[model samples]
Target: MSEPKHVVIIGSGLGGASAAAALRERGYSGDVLVLGSESHRPYELPPLSKGVLLGDAEEPDWVREADFYADKNIDLRLGTTAVRIELGGRLVHDGSGGEYRYDRLLLATGSQPRSLPVPGTDLPGVRTLRTLDDSLALRSAFSAAERIVIVGAGWIGTEVAAAARKHGAEVTVVDQIQAPLEPVLGAEVAGVFRDLHTEHGVGWRLGAGVAEFAGGPDGVRSVKLTDGTELPADLVLVAVGAAPRVELAHAAGLDLSDDGGVCVDATLRTASPDVYAVGDIAAQFHPRYGKRLRVEHWANAKYQGEHVAGNLLGEHEPYLSSPYFFSDQYDLGCEYRGLADPDNDELVVRGDLKSREFTAFWVRDGKVTAAMNVNSWDDGDALQSLVDNRTEVTPTQLREADLAGLG
Candidate 1:
């Protein structure tokens, strides 16, 4: 097929911005336009919950310099929301009544934070962190907050607890799950995180649901749990989870997956031939895993964005990489690679778990499915290689200090 004459990308997050950059770098001089819902340029999300919430960074990590798009002759419209997509005519409509026709279209519409389904959520101090503005607002609130209550023990919830503690706020995290990150990291590994936060003076009320956000006109005053227990708090953060932004695609009659994202083939193309989806909103058929999986991590956004650019130019290569994500809470930092289920995989540990320095591997039927290194950066490559290659390893081999023979 002939190269697309014009490419329009909706949602100017990291994935969309990276696609535009890759297109330009690959010598595609086509007309490229990127529509961003936020006023600011595309920025990374990791810093929002870490450095930005901690008040250590004033601004987000930009995916590209503000001048990069202009220099490449790319039309990047900020603070623009795409309202509709007409697949029949290959046109996209924005909120301002502006319409653009394109030879190829990309839906990089990322996800939004899920709000706590409880009363008084709209109160002044009850907030959710998903954007740069949200992080700034939380950072400002944390400065004077005496007691902060975070609903959920996910990455954002735990990270916010660390930040709140650093700001000298008495923090308590409440979650429906029995342990933080239990579903993703399994119980053995999740216990380490729970202990780490506990050691840092972060309180937890696990396996409990939020019945209500008790507050008056002033702001949130306390969080009432399902067990009729109430915890007083001046600030509250609801980080339950996020839902993919797929309204435009749904209205356009696109196919959606059970995972709540736009369904795509192995090449990241939607049902419509010239349309594509990437990042957190894409439920793509992974070639390596042989299943349709949607990843909501930074690495997926960065790599899939660049990969889709090549496919848009007729490269038609399949994305076969494993899912990966990292988190930093206080002095404990860890990186996880691959996809594994706690219910099906057996957990094995290497190095010292007590000292907070170790590599944990999830093996399924003698093959390594996933691995994580906590404060042990040197073994990252070895662990990643094992997961990527589906290397068959015994518990004894995985526990061995030498990783030279794993690959």
Candidate 2:
């Protein structure tokens, strides 16, 4: 295959932005065009929920400095959305009635926040953190909010609860699950987050689903739980989850998985060799896990963006890096490495959970599958190596041995 003359990326978030930069770094002098629906340059989303919401960060976490795109000769079109993909013609149609031909196409459209189906969500005080603008608006609301009710006890909800509490607002989190992040981290491990939020003066209404929001013209007044309990609130955040933006891919006849993303092989190439997908919109086959995973995290977007750039240039190497992510809530900052089905994996703790400083590992068949360090920042590389190398170890070694010295 020859080097592509024109590489067009749909979506200007981190994944698309990183790919554009990586392509230039790899000496691909092709015409690199990045189309983003947002009016701003490519930025990271993690800060929107954490630093931006807390008023600690004032600017978007630009994927690269603002001048890097133009300096690298990457044509980044902000406030533009790719609405249609003509796979047969190798052309993309934007929402503004513009079409561009591409020698290679990468779709990194990413995902959108999931909203509650219940009524009153359209109220003025209701919000969902996704973009830079949303975070700024939330920051403003947090300053004046007397009570904040966050729906869904996932990462976003928990983080928002922390920020709101820091603003001196009465925060209450509602979720249908018994514990926050139970499905992903398991009840015992997820308990760490629950304890963290509780200790931070945040309230919880777990194992309960939202019924509706009772509001007036000014804004939402209170949240009504399915159990008939009414919690007064000046602001409500629906943080259930996100759905991948795959309408263009679906319309173009790309193979979509039941997981709700475009199916791609090890190299992040879709069914069509000239087309690729990454970030939240890509259900990529992980060589390490021997399965397709659609990871929705900052690390996935950053790493996959770089990995797919090589494939776009015909490198054909498989992305072997394990799934990783980090989160910061209040004073606690942590990094999580690898994928784990907490329900079946054997969990082992290295430090004290109550002390708010610990390392938790999930092992399967005597091999560490995933690990999380609550406040132990130095254990990141060791944890990554343990999971990436698939090193076998017993519960005793995991709990007692120094991770840096472990096999």
Candidate 3:
């Protein structure tokens, strides 16, 4: 396809906004229109759980300034919900009964926090943190709430526990799993997170399930566990997980992954011609992993956005970058690069795990599949290079203090 005259992007999250900017950067003179359901302009998601919730950062980290859209001649439509995709006509219908025609359409609808299915979830104080509004509401609740009960010990739950504890709120985190973050970070590494929260006075109820939330008119009163124990809670935060927004894609007969994400190839192109998907909603083929994967990390979204733009401009190349993510809780800050399958790999630690200032490597078949650095700085780029290059190194070499040059 020749350079399209106009590109219509749905959803104004980081991926959507970055795609617009990247198209312009790549010298595409085509008109760009970004439709966002949220009123706020594109902002980073990390701060919503950390800085924004703790009142440490008030202003949002915008993807671009207000003038950026105007200067670049990009039409940014906020607070607009895309109701339907007219696949036959190549147009999008918004809730306001407006139709937008496009030479190409990119879906960056992102994902939403999964809601709890139990009763009393609709209570006033029971919340889930996903957007800036949710963060603001929790911040206000945190300032006044004495006892807080967090469901699920995932990244969002764990981070919120840290913020609540830091704000002097009595925090209790409950998860059905034996170790928090065990599924992703593995049992050994997840223990680190458990210790971090425990040291900060955060209560843990592992191998426990929430039966129901009992509350009065004032708000959520307490959470009832399956073990027949009731824990008093002034507020409840549910951090189970997220689900991709793929209704439009599904309705339009676009391919979808088994996990409900829009299915796309390595170039981020959907089965239908002229249609593309990116960000959390896109189950994109990763050349490195040799499989289609949907990643929710901010860095992956940003990279996919830029990479999709190149492909959209006819610079066709596979999206092969390794998965990466990071987190901050208490004084601990960590960055993990590459996809690490704990079941298939052996973890090797470089520094003392007890000191919590070390780099851990996931070695599979004598090659570094992933590396994580906790409370350590200035090694992310090198670690990422090691993964990208598929560097082969032994466990003893990984434990060496001067292992930087070895890889």
Ranking by TM-score: 1, 2, 3
Candidate 3 lands at a TM-score of 0.98
> How displaced is residue 76 in candidate 1, in Å?
0.6
Tens-place lDDT per residue, model 2, 158-237, is 88888898899999999999998899899987888898888888889998899999999999999999999999999999
Query: Would you list the rank order by lDDT, best first?
Result: 1, 2, 3
| lDDT value, residue 116 of candidate 3 | 71
The Cα RMSD in angstroms, rounded to one decimal, for candidate 3 relative to the true structure is: 1.1
TM-scores for all candidates: the values are 0.99, 0.98, 0.98
Can you give the lDDT of residue 249 in candidate 3? 95
- Candidate 3 per-residue lDDT, tens place, 1-407, comes to 67888799999999999999999999899889999999998998999988998789996689999899989999999999999998899999999999999988999999998987788888889999989999998998898899999999998999999999988999999999998898887899989889988999999999999999999778999999999989999999999999999999999999888888998998899998799999999998878888889999899889889888977776678888888889998899999998889877899998888889999899899999889999999787779888998888888877864666865
lDDT of 1 by residue, 161-254 (tens): 9999999999999998988999998887899999999999999999899999988999999999999999999999999989999999999999
> How does each model score on lDDT?
0.92, 0.92, 0.90
| C-alpha RMSD of candidate 1 | 0.9
Q: lDDT, candidate 2, residue 75? A: 98
Q: In candidate 2, which residue pairs get closer than 3 Å at backbone N, Cα or C atoms, i.e. clash?
A: none
